[model samples]
Target: MDDDSATGVAMTRNGSTGERQLEGDYLTNAQGEDVVAGIRMTKDLSELKKEMPDLYAEFERIALLLEKHYREMQDMEFTIEKGKLWMLQTRDGKRTAQAAVRIAVEMADEGLIDRQTAVRRVKPEHVDFFLHPQFDPAALAGGKLLARGLNVSPGGAVGQVAFDANMAEAWAKNEGKAVIMVRPETKPDDVHGMLAAEGILTSRGGRTSHAALVARQFGKPAVVGASAITIDLTNREMTIGERTIHEGEWISIDGTAGVVYEGQLATMVPDIKDPWLIKLLDWADSFRTLGVWANADYPRDARRAVEYGAQGIGLCRSEHMFFETDRLPYFQKMIMADYPVERREALAALLPFQREDFAGLFRVMDGRPVIIRLIDPPLHEFLPDLVELVAELADLKIQLKHAPDMAAIDALLSDIRQKEQLRKRALSLREANPMLGLRGVRLGIYIPELTSMQVRAIFEAACMVVKEGIDVHPEVMIPLTSHVNELIRQRTVLEGEARTVMAEQGVTIGYKFGTMIELPRAALTADRIAEHAEFFSFGTNDLTQTTFGISRDDAEAGFLIEYMEGGILPANPFATLDRDGVGQLIDMAVRKGRASKPDLECGICGEHGGDPQSIALCHQLGLTYVSCSPFRVPIARLAAAHAALQETGRPHDE
Candidate 1:
């Protein structure tokens, strides 16, 4: 009715209040109702409403007819002015990727889209999303959505929604289902469910959440800040600000865009690759013949990335190897074990586990190059809290006059206290500003054994897999090194043990040693580090962290929201490469590093690996490859194509 600003196409409804339709730049409700919105066009709405009411009615008639004809959601724009109605735009409504493909393919089969259109509809990236691990779609039909947040990662999960992550993990194990991890905000503790969940859903957090980042790292589906849905733990039901559903039920979460849908909606791949992804990479490949790659975290993800045509794996975070349900207790013991002898014993027990993981990885990659980053997070991450241990031990001592497992409890408490002291010392060692802290090289320097054990595992896995007739190529990447000597030291130790092991096995297999150019210093001195290294996998996650001095985990909820909305940042730097700043660093490193060692291999292992923009940037920089999550491999390839074409054509940036 009030159509002063909106580009309303006037139509008569019983001639009571002359309603209008929305055309170019005008916002119309799903039912074509006027909501205060419009874009300026040359059409004269005042004259049209006065002169051509019948034509306007005809246009609305067509929209209704088309909706009936298609039997699905539709979006359209119409112009009605000066006694004439005009059709300006028409397309299927914006839909979930699942619905997008299904509708496209089904409609195409039903003669909606042509053969050429069908081919265009099926995006390689969309297919990758569809093929990845998903929760039991059947289970989610009973639950309801509580909130809507950014779906930074993709996958599925179902469990009794636990307010806390530990309880979520416990309930997941007890109920024998993947966890639906709910939290106001996540911390390092959620890394456990980020490990345990089939998919992750959080009440708080956003695209850069520890939950989101960890999920992306592990290739898990994650929905953050479903603030719309209210979780009531006492009654065990969630209300979507409307209807309420009880616990133990399910809700389907789409991690692509943070939308939660009702029921186990059927899923399909993307019908159309975003023209952006395709066009961007096509531009890159023309400039550089880099072999785009991906960092796969799981078997299915491995295949998905390969299907996207990634040349090889640049980084496979081997720490995720110890996150499996069967492995965490052992991992905890390995971390908390008081003596080196005990730690080594625990690590020895993990060798077979690590070997099996590598075997699976090799099987998935089918012996392709997989550069694995050794264990990264601090030891305290794997251990229980010292405060909790103290409280529990005291509680047990008080509740039971004698005590139950008092010795073990006291021992655990004592060990926790000691570890706390070590943690404090580590924190002191930690940079007051930790992105530059004693994280990467410092951790390796202080805990050389941790790196050694993992190197032994990699070599041992390589040897075993080679015996099984798989041509496995393993590479080792050291994280957070500012100076060349740090890499030289790590490489010396790795090569020495690797040589000794190879001599013992009598199988001459090759492995590459590399350092993550994640610090400004490392990138600046890449030429120096390249001297002893065979490859460089840019860990942009840390590089960006170091560059901006922003803790990705800390900024998502509080400042990033305002920063993005305020236009302080163009896009999420972690999600997309900050081409101007971080990218320049990569370019500098590549040029300088290759200058030192012409044959040195260079690629990326940051979240940017799969980002189309990052892919194009990497290609332009002449790196040998770019690596990303398996799901993003297809997007990267098409993006590579886009980049290639654009590079050669020098097309204007979109």
Candidate 2:
């Protein structure tokens, strides 16, 4: 053992099977806890070597012997007092993803391990870490690190502070500043803020918590369960020991490292220039049996997915496209239109936009299959918030009452009345339970033109792509489908639109139509529905919601955490698959759906798709594919490979 270095000098590999390094630290005139607890500034093992060369040489010799004896790396701890060296402890060293890959590959090449053994050494989570950006080494070395926490998501983030979700969103959206949302813990209501923020820092909650789960899903940099920091929401500041960080203070965070820095720090994007990871993924693909796809909506997402090795587009939620700034007007106009002609005209205005959107996606995906789900949410989602509209109308009425000019007063009154009408319409559209209300296939059935316009755009885009000699497999997916008739009705409408577009473009292209088996009834009666549907995509998000009768949006914020802490639920069913209840439904659907139509293709396009555990379950259940967000494509690929290896009785390190 050597003094002034790592507490325990170990020659052992990390959880990731990373390469071992002579890693240790030393603080002058301090106890071992000072160095171990990181309470004092510390120097690396090299500093000790510089101070005592003879002792350092002897320590290195013993370390090598320890590794040889164990046939692996070792972690060691020792002390040197009065020019005498002492070996206190020795074990394997922990390392980063890069070190893990480099070490394993080098070990295999060095005859320390076989190729299969090396492959088995790397964890799936480590593979995921390779895909995220890191803080620049030089910048991080110079930066002031405030605290450490569990890294729920992997990436580097730099932004000003925001105390709560509302502040986070307001700062990001209104001030146009990237913000790190600081919270005691997060709730479902914080999603908007989470989306707007560049990173999230919470004082409580572990990896499987709501905050962490959503952060991963959003692909944000997140550090959770940070106990060192105390959040003072009343003052909009966070206190770490004696240091207080106020709102809007510039800060940087490394989710991969789980370090919160005092100010902005430079970041290095993943080393895509290095072909090592690319080669590794290719190797993974060779061994993996499950198909990994992406839940992408736009061309950008599709392109990202393709770059990350997504096999195809498993879910293209077209409704998300409507939320884009330029396209929202057409969507809102269609929603507010009183007559079918007006709505159709609004949809007509949107047709070219949708066609172009689909065309771009096809171009990016090339010949890969793209499953596009038609509009699924209720129309109210396209309108202004009912409460906000009413408040605006009330303020307008007050202004009208105070107006000095008669003409101005009359105009104000007219405007107020118009606002009131829109507000009333929005209210009328609102349901006590919107998720279980008029959404998905029901929306398509009730509002024929909505589905018609989307189908028309899809078919027309396909025809255009086919005329250009690019093979495009466009699948129209009807969401929230619970019955055979819903599938048949939407299929008929989609087929009619397909015919119309084909005839109009003077081109023919084959397409598939499917329904999302979200409702329990749909899964239970999958055989009957499969007869009318060409494919099935399990919408596990809503499936979990309906199965447990839990409102995903509101549950976590309310009693979900309590239930979790109380051990009422093993995990957040929304975050992870509830295999017994929700999984049973999934199993039954896959079995029955395939029994009815042996050629039926099935996959899951939900939040669960990106979860490694859920991916394993899907693999075990024989699902064709699992689709997740574009950023999760790499994670899913690695997870799928891990699952395949585990099933085949190969080394499953993860």
Q: Of the candidates shown, which would achieve the greatest lDDT relative to the real structure? A: 2
lDDT of 1 by residue, 588-634 (tens): 99999999999989888888887777777887888888887766666
RMSD of each: 10.6, 4.9
- Report lDDT (CA) for all predictions: 0.66, 0.83
Candidate 2, TM-score vs. the true structure? Answer: 0.83
lDDT of 1 at 449: 76
- Positional deviation of 256 in candidate 2, in angstroms? 3.9
- Model 2: weakest 10-residue lDDT segment is 1-10
lDDT of residue 435 for candidate 2: 81
RMSD of 1: 10.6
Best candidate according to TM-score: 2
Could you give candidate 2's per-residue lDDT for residues 1-654 as a string of tens digits?
Answer: 233333323344443335455656655445567667866677777776787788778888887778667655666777666566678876556777777667766665566665555666677677777667778878988999799999889889899999888888998999999899989998878888999999999989898787886787667999999899999989888999999999989989888878899988998876643455565666677777889999998898898899888989999989988998998988888888889899999999999999999998988888899999999988889888998998898899789778999999989988887787789779889999888899999999988998898998898888888888788999889999888888888888779888988999998887888999999999999999999888999999999999999888777666886687568898889878998999999999999999999999999999999888999999999999999988778778778877888889754332
